[model samples]
Target: MAAAMTRMLQLLLITTLIHVARGKVRVQITNMIGYKDDMNITCQSSDDDLGQHVLSYGQSMEWKFKPNFSKTTLFHCNARWCDVMRRIDFGAYEYMKDHYGCGSDCRWMFTIDGVYAYDSKTDSWDFRFSWYS
Candidate 1:
């Protein structure tokens, strides 16, 4: 019985170490909407709701989390500004795609043109997509 317990403890310790080594992923979204507009934002995953926020120009909202072990983690956000009638829904992070693209620090910028994502490998921002009407 003691031998079995020791083996179990070893497995538990290894699992914990692995998780720690992987660390948490950091995501940040900033308002670059200009013209002094306050952007209304809401973000969530299937398992979590980050609630709503109002970000002024140059302001940012950030969060950190570890990717789901099954590799299916995803988070999306909705943004509204300027015209209250207009809103943009966007994919904030997807483990399968972002893990390799943005690395640990996933930064996003929103502007009148569209959404931009930071690419760690190149140390630059890439235009992701335009606002969908």
Candidate 2:
């Protein structure tokens, strides 16, 4: 009976973990610029604010998002340098899942000129960026 109880507990834990994992998405943003100037970063989707931060040279920030009822969600990050703003957008689930599985976390690196999304499987970056002054 004790052995059976232990197996049941393990199964329960696995199920709970899978449920929790499905509810959220994790992502990281890194600053690859050489300058010390701080960059203001903001992330939003479907008018919902995910987070905001300021990153200095070689700094990185990680954030998590819980998607709403929409499978087609738009996630965007904006980085400001002086008067210029560089914005990068991801289809959130579509892009992240294509590269990093929904159960896995993803990362992105930002440079002064562009942005790159990290692929953990290949250990490489896929450039994705847009600039606006």
Among all candidates shown, the one with the greatest lDDT: 1
CA lDDT scores, all candidates in order: 0.88, 0.66
- For model 1, which pairs clash? none
Q: Which digits, one per residue and each the tens of the lDDT, describe model 2 over residues 49-79? A: 8677888888887766654443454576667
* TM per candidate: 0.81, 0.62
lDDT per residue as tens, model 1, 36-125: 788999999999899999999999999999887787989999988876755888889898998887878999999888789888788888
- Separately for all candidates shown, the number of backbone clashes (residues 3 or more apart, or on different chains) is 0, 0
lDDT of 2 at 51: 73
Model 1 ranges with Cα > 4 A deviation: 1-21
Global local distance difference test of model 2: 0.66
